[model samples]
Target: MANDGLSAGAAARRLGVAVTTLRTWHQRYGLGPSRHEPGHHRRYTVEDMVRLQVMQRLTAQGVSPAEAAAWARRAPSDASLSGGSPDASGGSPELTAADLAGFPSAAPHPGASGRSGVSSDVAGGSADPVDSVPAARVGDGEGGAPADLAGGAPADLAGATPAGLVGSAPAGGGQTIPLGPRANPAARGLARAAMRLDGPSMRYIIEAAVTGRGVILAWIHVIMPVLIGIGERYEATARFIEVEHLLSRTVTEVLAAVPRPPRDREPRTLLAAADEEQHTLPLEALAAALAEQGVPTRLLGARVPSQALLDAVNRTGPVVVVLWSQLPGSGSIDQLERIQAVPHPPLILAAAGPGWPVEGLPPTVTTLGDLASAVRLIARATSD
Candidate 1:
């Protein structure tokens, strides 16, 4: 923060990112520091810091790194330092709709859900219902397209819906995943990128949400909505399976990228999907969330056989084990029973996801209703 500038470490700390990330930005995107001395390493000048902040904010909001760098490089030298702009609050200017004119606005499809409420199952508690807003009519002048996201929709995806549906809506008319009326801008941006099959953009938006809002908030507010919206789209149309798969893959990658506790720290918590359940995004979210709290966990992803799970618990001696099942067919009570009957049973045995039956759970088995509760319960159990 000196008049001269800040070192790479100091700047990374200020931006809440790793020094290597700064290095990457500098090396790949040309957003490096300019201040140099005859006998010292370069430091990030105030202007450079402003540029970096812009880059960080945009990327966090789901803008691709390349595009974000372009905008950051164009930021005014004193945009954040000098008190001269119209809204001179001593920070970067808020990017307006006009500024993001290049990105396509996600138009609402006729068949998309109009409600803007979060489901209780996904929200991790009682559903918070907002008054339903009718689905915006696309192609009509009243609602030409949804509001523009920070990272504009990619060009090819502007009017293209997924291929091979029975009766596909016209291009540019119903190409979007219906996120309801009040979806988060980041969620909308992510959906746009997913529909475009733009992996880099999807990763950028997800990583940004996870970085800026923590695993829990990011999952609840941003990632879950898109996932649900896409699921609904698939249910209604029985199409866009490709979009779902790519988005799921991108989410998995981003969540896996979250840093874990030190190698020396032993993992005491174990997470696994039920015997035939393949839906592990929730579990992945849980793992990342636990990692954020400095907890290490063993995640046996997707369709973990009961014996394999029991063997894992017996070998690792985990204090907490959470089993997830996404559908009734996959929620086998025998899996939970067998784990509980292990010679040295885990201290906390939890059944998560909607698959588990409501009535006949074992006395010792705890139910994890949502991501927030799972993180808190498992983190506490492990810490104990």
Candidate 2:
């Protein structure tokens, strides 16, 4: 077929994606056939096919469809789509993560994984990961929150975005997490993908962020705002728990994929969700963020019982132990009291997540306010 183009069915077959999916991509993302003739239907040019392939592969790798579309929209002509030689064409040959989202990209780092690494190219290890994420500022306004600020925990999400869409329904359909008018394009892309439960699109956006901006920036600027916005939606309508769960699972997968601290360096930080507490995404973020700085943490993961937590602490003998709680009921004071009462308590006993009471009974316990502050504090506390 000449550059005149391939039919939708043919394009679908070639890309190995369904025609309906192709339609969705075209309608939702503007990744449609660009070639037209006098009497026939529009056909997908080679470039269009190439763009669709990019969208498909990225989504399959756990990137959200909407975000994949964003990248696809600006994709280079003849972009590598599996087994063909791409004929380089008109646009910039290279597309930076910043270019896709209108944000700054991290310098390439030898230490970070390709797209999966918690990469940071800053020298001297002095650059703050949280500080490096670009602002989510929609536009300059007195009422808008500055974009450079980072969110710490679920409780710290008030700083995530400038506007909240508490009761608003989305433009196309059912519901949406409220986004500011000037929301980061990447964030907007992520929100659209999550709303549609487009898991691959979400992963692509996040993994791309992790690859281009490091774990902390990815979470702070891309994943965190969507989370808080969705949580607000759930609060208002009591719906979309599935959306929340899918997004969280995707985040957990990506964060877990971040390279761990070297095996030679023993893990000195112990992380666990409080008893009966199921929320641990924040803790996962902390673990990955710490790992970015070459710090190892033994994450006990969600809903660890008090006894099991204590047993792990005793076994690991970590220098710092961080307990996470996402709600008040699960953020019990007794857990802290008992941990403090352990025969060998970690040097730093930290309370994380928003579930814990600010005024607590345990004197030795310290509250972790947000992701960056937690990472910064724990890395320092357990410095070898």
lDDT of 2 by residue, 33-62 (tens): 999988999999878877877766544332
After best superposition, candidate 1 residue 366: deviation in angstroms? 0.6
In model 1, which residue pairs have backbone atoms overlapping below 3 Å?
103-152, 159-172
lDDT, candidate 1, residue 266?
Answer: 97
Name the candidate that leads on TM-score. Answer: 2
Model 1 ranges with Cα > 4 A deviation: 1-174
Candidate 1, residues 1-384: lDDT per residue as tens digits?
798899999998886666866887898789998999989999999889888877765544434456667777876563443222222223233323322222222322222221111222223321111223222122111112233211121111111122221123222324445455554556655665655455676787778677776777676556655655554455455555566677777878988999999999999999898887766766777889899999999999888998899899999999999887766688889999999888999999887765678789888888765567777777778886
Worst 10 residues of 2 by lDDT: 113-122
Write down the lDDT that model 1 would get: 0.61
